[model samples]
Target: MTDLIEPDALLFNPFMPGFFEDPYPQYKMLRDEDPVQNHPLGFWFVSRFDDVSALLKAGLSVEVGNLAPGVMMDQLDSLGIEDGKHGVLNMSMLDRDPPDHTRLRSLVTKVFTRRAVAALEPKIVALVDAVLDRMAEKGSFDLVEELAFPLPFAVISEMLGMPPTDHARIRELSGTLVRSLEVVTDEEVARAIVNADIELAAITRDLIEWKRANPGDDLLTALIAAEHEGQVLNGDELVAQVVLLYVAGHETTVNLIANGVNALLRNPDQLALLRERPDLAGNAVEEFLRYDSPVQQTRRITTAPYTLRDKEIPAGTFVLACLGSANRDERFFGADAGELRIDRPEARHQVSFGAGPHHCLGAALARLEGQVAVSRLVQRFPDLAFDGQLEWNGRINLRGPAKFPVRAT
Candidate 1:
């Protein structure tokens, strides 16, 4: 594909108006025009399905420390940020490369397997039904508030055996901290992210000590007990992992349920079809992920010179793998790639949870949660429809509605 944006013309400006509410058009432009976009900011973006898929499993470096002096790093430095200062964010497996990522992922992979998630199915079903029961009485409610957010939040809290606290505070902190994953260019936003990470880290530290003292049959307790190579996860590592869980555990599923339902409502034909064929629940979740991925883009810093489509990308180059675009690529998903088809066979091929080494550990859990939550809601509420205007979450990386009002008879 030929680059569309001329030199001095920015190929990707995430701040482009209306980009957040619906990034698909922009993503399509990138995929069709500059499949391997070299941004003026000194980084690259791979939007085509084949390239994005290959890049994820290419064994490239994910560690920011491996990045050469570039625009992103310079921006961070200008924000008065010191290296290794964001301990809670920096130490997680999400940012690690190779051996460290492997070690950290190994510690928790067993708990998120298909069979493990199956064991938790009853709990998920019960949770979904319970929320639906409450919504049943109201007849109309904000789906995001009443179900989407709380279900995953409560599930993760229960899984970790966390004590009751201010749920709103945690939600607020979690939302703020997610901006760390985006391209933060504002000074105030950067400071807010740094502050939020610190506060959340403190809360996690206290939670860890409490869990250590009062261990039980839960993920946190299990992490406390887990050992690798005769060495247990230390203080900093423990905090990072727990925080990562708290965020990833709920964030991904919340988007799935909310975005999935929103998609169904928008495409009434598909929604009616889903209502008729509830068996498509599992496949429906995959379509939801592909139609509108929760986590849109993932980054990797090249540890060595890499060549793609005849262009040689040098070592230490930062690359943003556009997962959302790849999921919608016409070359891979056929001519109607833009449309939401619930039964699409290639839906599961979407790279929403990503692929390769850092693919989301909580994917199976998220899928199960989404399948149950979305399926039961449609089944329970025969007249499910939009109640009011939808509000986008204003995030470029994680796309979902902030407020999803719906009414059902």
Candidate 2:
């Protein structure tokens, strides 16, 4: 396959079918040939492990989101679009810089603490069991639809104290919004994204009102009352925060479990190793994160001129930190980086959940969900294996099987 492609071809061509199915080969080429290549479309692609790690630690100097004013405006112009969506975009700390980001994160931290997350273990376990039971009834199932998607979606929704009656609607809306991140050439996706954003905004607004009237011991209720320095989140802020949680919490863990299961099935040795020592479940989860990262790449805009790998990147430039490529970079994980090894000592060093202040806020919850789901699947179904052709989600940024058929004996 490597022989068929041009030696200098950049792996980021969204339309390239070969790159979408298996991008690691192209990523390896980028790491070796041009670790810090700037895209003609206007962004720096950082593929090497060391370079990605350094950029992550750069903190607020490198902000998240492609909508940063200068280059982002240029991008919009190039697309023949007008204006920006700051109202909705600013709500997510994942896309904000310091001050606003810090304040929003602090407000959210009051509710989404480690203890709060830890307390959900039993609930998560039960949810996992319930999901598996449904899968068992079928004997054969789409692991993603039955277990991966539902488990985390249910857990996160319950944590938010959303009414059970609205769970299906919220889940559907969140899925639509997340799918907007895919590399689609059609205007249908764009229209869907815009509509989903509008619908999510309305749904969250109503949820906030409901929580205000009937407060419960849930994250949403806590978020409603949460304040820092006597400053509380406004209505828009509240809606945005809820939407952020819904989007982030839903997709990442779904892909994590789905991707992890696929990795385990593909690497029988590691699966056997995990099956023998279930104690390695935690370590194995980390490897799954590194092996097939849920969130492939994250955007960071340069606030100031920054030097990375001897290349001086100017301010306002959008830099894509390729977490997927970095995770497989041979320099960090050694020559056997391409292979899945559950016992890899340095697997935790992976930036799958990212690093520094702007790192994923729901990392703890996602990790817990991944650990329980993957471990339970291995233990309960001793002969678990792929039952049919795997269907990739076809998203360049979020890689996972859309329909992973598996047989559990």
Candidate 3:
């Protein structure tokens, strides 16, 4: 006879701050004990790799019509997104299902092709070298603030055609917007929403005006010139797209670099392997993505009742896929699943960039940035070691070190 799960085992509360400190244990328990557990806060938590992968690949269909304003409101409130419906429009690619998603994604997909990203390798290496040169003189550095955060931010800023002078301003705005994503309380969420709306809207409007008057051979200019079947995006759409690329491109990459560096410091032998064989940078980036994904969780709502692993999920139910847990699931990754093995044979199968239609649009850029950043850091500072205790940003959805102090030898 099969073992029976208790009614209490069906729920897992993720809101607890303790989970943010070390959620892997809770995630393991959830995966082993209840793969399809529901939360009292009104969402089903899918922890196992297979279950989460199935739901992402097949269960809940993605359609713009199914994009609930309430769900967006909750997400926005959590992230402190304040441009109201305008922000939602910019995120249409992620929110919409096929046809719409297919149409929209095609427009910008060419810009991020593998060849394009590969071409950027030399430029990225140069940038990383420059940043490290400055850091070497200091002998001590905060990786997140000095290198990881700025490198990707600078790259995206250049791609968007933003002037170097405005990089600091853009970074500030992006930081605020990203923090808004983690604000849990209603009051804090409301404040974040208002701040983002006023600031981002103004920034977007200014950029649009500048792009119209002073066109350059850059992504923004390309976006402005882009026309599809005699249809062109208006100023609003252009601004939204720019903001989306600017924030999403750098914010997640920042975490990936920081998290990857931290993981390497914890594993000396793996760090040594990466430092010696920089060619492994590519696989190392994939391993980092799988080992500790920047994006920890993402949600989808069920439009129709579905049976997943014998558990009945009613229509309109919200499902949270714990990617962090799923990535480390032993069932998919053998016994030593938690270890950070740079040569892990099956690392590519991880869903850190997600799967199906809604896969991260910036996946190519992220990988390029990660490989460049990680390889260069090890090469630049051969004796780099943790200088102090790391401080992590207390966020459930986003996983990354807030500050990573290191001493260069």
Candidate 4:
């Protein structure tokens, strides 16, 4: 590979701060000209919807953690932190391959079924109303803080049997963990690792111990008691599962709600349509996920040499599936690909939640949260408008607003 072209031109440096401010342009260029661009760093960038979808469905790969540990190790090294033995948070069923993945997913699938998620709807609605009530009194607010952040926190917290008082503490810790996702200088990385380690260890240990002793009627307790006759989650496995659920369950939903709201704010006509027809809220959330997904990109590695779209990707090459870009590819989505339209017939087909076996476990929970949060917010504040310049979180893989100030009438 005689260094085909400038790495910068083919693969955008997502670690850079400027990329976060605007990745769409870079993504558009890649999708148009280099759908399978080879990067100098020995990875293939897949930006088209069909190509990315095919790769995901192909399933001839390992999870990003095992395959491209450097992706994470480099992140950890940059932060001056010694990585722990990779555990469940990094090894959920979603992260594992075939047999193991199948077993692990089967064990946890019962807990997140549509019926189970539906049971939480009433509670979710209550949480949304309570948050909106407070925000209504203020007349203006940051939706991320006042509504988007806490709604999912409450829903997931209760599901895991955590107390409401711990919501603030857990939310703070989750924020710190998410910040660690941004590729930053060693100093910042060190701070993030220390913060994440302390908070995650303390919270996971405390909750696991409590669930062990008290034996509550919550997901944590159930996971603790779950077994396959002789097989069960070991101490570390149990802890990792809790940590995974805590982080994935809430962090992504936070982005979904925030990103969804930001999408509506940016598209006033769409916002008006949603305001007038709350029935479209569900479909609209799907479109929002496609337009600005919470998880922007995911990595995969080839098990052996493979040819894709006329390019040969060797073993050990990291494949970056730019989901955010793929969702807007004109070939799959047509001319209005980038536009936010609830009426679009193909909006539901977006790969925002991903495809294949690793599709988000909490997709149902996220959808419920998004629908309720957006519908109620729009209904309560029909005149909601952006009140200040939006500040985006500088994270490569997560697309969301850091601060979305809005005025509600």
lDDT string for model 1 (99-215, tens) is: 888878888775545676677889989999998999999999999999999999988898888988778888899898888777666667767777788788888888988888888
Candidate 3 per-residue C-alpha lDDT over 117-182 given as tens digits, one digit per residue, 9 for 90 to 100:
677778888999988998899999899989888899888877777754566666776766665443
Decreasing lDDT order of the candidates: 1, 2, 4, 3
lDDT for each residue of candidate 4 in 142-218, tens digit (9 for 90 to 100): 98888887788778888888644566666677666654443333455546555564567667877777778877778
In lDDT terms, which candidate is top? 1
Alpha-carbon local distance difference test for all models: 0.84, 0.80, 0.75, 0.76
Among all windows of 10 consecutive residues in model 1, the one with the lowest summed lDDT is: 66-75
Judge candidate 2 at residue 110 and give its lDDT: 80
> What TM-scores do the predictions have?
0.93, 0.91, 0.88, 0.90
Off by over 4 Å in 3: 1-11, 15-17, 59-91, 179-183, 232-235
Tell me which of candidates 1 and 3 scores higher on TM-score: 1
Cα lDDT of candidate 4 equals 0.76
- In candidate 4, stretches whose alpha carbon ends up further than 4 angstroms from where it belongs are 1-8, 15-18, 66-89, 164-169, 176-191, 194-199, 228-230
* Model 2 misplacement above 4 A: 1-8, 60-87, 179-187, 227-229
